[model samples]
Target: MSDTGLHPGLVRPRPQRRRARSRTYSATVRTLGPLALLVLWWAASATGLLTPDVLASPAEVLRAIGELWGNGQLPDALTTSLTRSALGLLIGLAAGLVLGITTGFTRLGDELLDSSIQTLRTIPFLSLVPLFMVWFGINETAKILLIAVATTFPMYVSTSSGVRSTDPELIEAMRSFGMGRLALVREVVLPGALPSLLAGLRLSMTLSVIALIAAEEINATAGIGYLMSQAQSYARTDILAVCILVYGLLGLTADVVVRLLERLLMPWRTPQGATR
Candidate 1:
């Protein structure tokens, strides 16, 4: 009898032990962890570690969200923020892809734009909010532009790096096949750079949101950022805390959505580093 293969789980009891440990670890992280933090927070609040007027407990934030939901302002705020973020993301991504691909492949373009972009990235995004306000005014245009400008550099850097990092063997194979320049870029470079592009996009979203807040606090009538600013003016720390929480959740949601997209687009990849 020739017994050829055994599953790792069948070959050794250790795999089952490892599986159990993994599940237990995940459960501990997901279930018990946040509850423990919540208790610590409540204890601190009770002990006056935080002034209730200036800071909020988790329960207060939840209550504030519930009140906003009941009042129908939450959805409006969400819509405004999401629309601005989406428009900025689209425009920024389009320009970044072009700039990155061009600069990555051309010595002339790299020499010209690389240092300029690096220098631009060194400047904090919030510094540009006032400048954007002066140039574009305090309309939706200004907010959208602020987000776009803030987001562009991350994508640009990631795109260039991703293009440069395309597997040399793959590029060699494509050249060996006598593919044209455009064909090589289309078939190899863009696809190879998607993971890094997504990562850049994730970073861009964070910057975009922060920029949105700084902009909306100036002239916007609606948005989570606008709402947060309003809450701040009224000294409603709980409401402001909830807005911050919502921002965190939204950021996490975007990341998860991008991760799912990466898995779908790069099915051949292993668990780690599949997108790039």
Candidate 2:
């Protein structure tokens, strides 16, 4: 043996090797699994095992994509979808983060908001859509409101619970050190709550995207959701499938952005997972 003791380079190399191995496995599994499914789907459609009336083949969807692309409808619809979803998500994140922190940190706030939140959470998300429409009209306001409301609760619950579950010993130590209220929150509580808050935010974003799509689909003049709805009227399943694919892609893109942000915001989080 060249060296019995662990060298500085050797110590780090083990972890680097393990990480690379893990990534290789993860990538292979994810890609191969999806590829297998796609092959099956393509085969089934080609063999007429699946009805084209109900399920468009990938080729058909691609052809429809070309048409949509040529018409310049795809870009316009995508822009509208992104804009509405982003706006709604921004509003919801702000409201939910503030409320969640206040309620989680204070007894008085918990007493005031808990019961109301509990009751409201039980109501179906879809049920609120019509109410939003009536209250705000069938305009961008209604769509945005619908998405924002859908996004709020998940974030509130996650952030509040994360705060509540923070290690009391750490909190006590901070208090013993004479940390002020704002500093305690800014330095301790918020950071402790961040992992959970991120989880809630991720959920909210996915939900908001869905809610916005529903809002647009029900009645709207623009957006991918509108295109999907319009296609259904004409029995254009290929275009409908294309819209669904776009929704999936957009959702994936949004989640990836959030994951990157989480990594930046919580560098302390290990590869193992978020602590909470």
Candidate 3:
């Protein structure tokens, strides 16, 4: 038999070719799945399979978005929501980082706070709505605090886990160099924990967005959630869909931002499944 025909079915591509194919497959699915779903949604809406009052069509949503923009309602709602989320996120991040570091690095701190935090994190943050409403009054403070509360646990947990998982040998080496508490953490611990911190940030931000929506929906008069509530009252599914999509896009944007930050801060870290 000729060499080319002897084992044609047995030929395997090179490793590079395999990786390229894997990446291509991953990208294709990520793109195509959303596109396919969009097409299906459009088809269903057009065929009346999805009732307008229940699920607005993409075109209706677009029109609603345009109308909101023209009337400046969307911009005001967006600003209000973003302001609340931003304030809450900053406060949550600061508290979580401080608490995480204290408990992560000190037995005394851990003994004093870790158990309580772990226990508290078990309860759904949303369950605090009634209590918050009573204490904070259905004001922006309550909504912002709700977002802060929802976001804190993820960051704290991830940071603690990351700190605990740092290499013992590396830590010992740092200690041998007469590294003080501040230097040790600044130089070694924080860098080691960057991945987990960023991961937690992503989760926390996403949760904050969700909590903001819930908080606003309950008693808001000037945010995206309030707009959504009004839309519901008016039976405007298109406006509701627009708000939902905006929330999704904001979450997606946050995730992408965190991923970019991770790449920027951890240049030495290996990309998953890529050859060094």
Candidate 4:
């Protein structure tokens, strides 16, 4: 009875069925790429096209993981690396939040601080290793500071942009209703900036892992990087591969944590399909 001689009920069901099929197809394709690569890697390794020295086979990497876990090296290294990363991330986030709010919310603060911070962020954090070593020595302080520095800029940029993106008319309306500065920021500015802040946190966490690798290389005695150094000295490619995999896992874990936080903090933004 509908236009084009098709029933309304039948047409609606067709589109829904098409969407379901499309979703299934997309999910399958997403996983297939990684599975295909894994199979190719295994085939190459089995055929002797990829040697252990050049790259450890997937099985050898698994065995190395078991060996490290059984011997307790992996646990201790994970704890140490995680501790340093946590401390640095906390410090960096706090500093970034303060700096971002000050500059993004106030004209005077922006004029005084934004340019300097922007210039500093442009310099590669790794290049400051020598200076950090000289200033703080090759101790825990230097390593933690290195990660802190690496993580700070992402939060700063994200926070600033988010805060600035807030609707000025809404802010004015709040002001007309007698909202104080602190109240305005707490209710309006911070909420508006939250998505950007979460994004920054995700980026900062990833950088913290990357910076951890570099920081641990500075004469570290007991961390994943130290294990990597020892593996390099002994030509244990399996161990090296294990360390690389661990780093990747850590990054993935950090991303998952941020996603969970997003879901918790921004329930309204959750996808409709996901809620179902």
Candidate 5:
């Protein structure tokens, strides 16, 4: 017996049951939007409202993907693009970390470097293409440097902001406890700034992918961008569609990787309705 005349056993749904229902509902709602768009796209293509010349149908894109995969072009391009992005990201991350820590931790460093970095950040990356081509001669060096440059600013800004956002009172307390500068930074500043750092990493990864597209356009002999250039020359709408889809997928994958990193690194940030 319970309030409202219900049996104790049925007084309320189990928490697990409620959580499961919530997750299921959320997933269904999330999937519906994309599914509806896909259906509409198929219908338009089927009804001749959308022409293959304008935009290839989803079926044609899928077939094109299979063709590329079977011929080994897709795998080779994917590997090359991934390698370039990874290398550029690593270099950019290292440079950003050093600059961010230097400017964030010391007033002298900030006064000397932050203004210049901020001014450089204001310049659009595309405008650097001509200079990079001239300096690096459209080689792998130019392409990698372009991606590295594109990814660096986001990480620098995020890291600087994150480090500066650390609680001053907590820092003072640690100082009073006889912590050295290196120890204080290692334990107090970095941990507190971890969320921001991870956010920066995520942004950097996304920028790396975007930069990859532009970098590959520099007289590229391989990679998705090269495939896109070839497809454009041959008027292969299906191949163009495949390239666009691959870029979208790469972006999606980067986002997913960051989310997983957040979950793993920030265990305290539990999802709503999670079992904690």
Candidate 6:
């Protein structure tokens, strides 16, 4: 014992242990806030402070959702809304990535394209809805295009910024090794820009959801927005509440999926204090 080189008291706890403790604490705080809000909501409803015509109680909302689910209405509406959002998001993401990469990587591309994109971006995307409706009609085409346009700007901005911010030193080092343009981009530029690109994806997903909701409200015969419109006309507060909850859940779910994808694709990125 006397020959021991170090004291046990001098040892530090493992980092994973510390991280686990912090994660548990943060999770508790997150749960507590939502739990408190739910309690307040239940209390207000039980006390009859919230009028049925304006706000439905949690129980009423639950029953309404159950009825809709049992009748297959909720599932059908969800499918329509989700399909439009997914298709629009894919189209937007592809276009944005190509344009961003071209402009970020070449002077000629930037000169020819960046100014036009910037000018268009300055004009509010939503303001084009009336024009889109006239051009595409109030059909699925208009709705999908509206969501796509709304989703594109964030991706373009973020990806361009990310690619441009990549280290010149890394580029030089890769060039010194006689790396081809494709290899340099694949190994250096894309890896370095991934974080920003993923952030943009998350933002685009959120905007797509919002734009889809608004687009559907215009003349939708099927989808959650249409359900809400019908519920409003009938003063069906329970159904309205259910629709609101579903919209929120969809947005939250999309954000979570994007974050998970980010973590998977960028495992080398530090994990602490990442935003929602």
Quote each prediction's TM-score: 0.81, 0.85, 0.88, 0.88, 0.88, 0.88
Model 6 scores a TM of 0.88
What is the lDDT of every predicted structure here? 0.80, 0.84, 0.88, 0.92, 0.90, 0.87
For candidate 5, which ten residues in a row score worst on lDDT? 12-21
**Residue by residue across 39-98, what tens digits does model 6's lDDT show?**
888899999887787699888999999999999999999999999999999989988888
Note each model's CA RMSD in angstroms. Answer: 6.3, 6.4, 4.2, 4.4, 5.4, 5.2
> Against the true structure, candidate 5 has what lDDT?
0.90
**Could you give candidate 4's per-residue lDDT for residues 99-134 as a string of tens digits?**
998899999999999999999999999999999999
Q: Tell me the spans in candidate 4 whose CA falls farther than 4 Å from its real position.
A: 1-30, 270-276
- When 5 and 6 are scored with lDDT, the better candidate is 5
Q: What are the per-residue Cα lDDT tens digits for candidate 5 across 76-186? A: 999988888899999998889778988998899899999999999999888898899999998888999999999999999988999899999999999999999899889
Q: In model 2, which range of ten residues has the least summed lDDT?
A: 12-21
Which has the higher TM-score value, candidate number 1 or candidate number 6?
6
On lDDT, the candidate that comes out on top is: 4
Runs in model 5 lying further than 4 Å from the true structure: 1-24, 271-276
For candidate 3, lDDT tens digit of each residue in 1-276? Answer: 447665555764556443334556666766897799899999999999999978999999999999999999999999999999999998888888888988998889999999999999999988999999999998889999989999999999999888888898998999998999899889999988988999889999999889888888667889899899899899999999999998998898898888778779987775575532
Q: What are the runs in model 1 whose C-alpha is more than 4 Å off? A: 1-33, 46-51, 172-178, 268-276
TM-score, cand. 3: 0.88
Off-target runs (Cα >4 Å) in candidate 6 are 1-25, 274-276
- Model 5 Cα shift for residue 218 (angstroms): 0.7
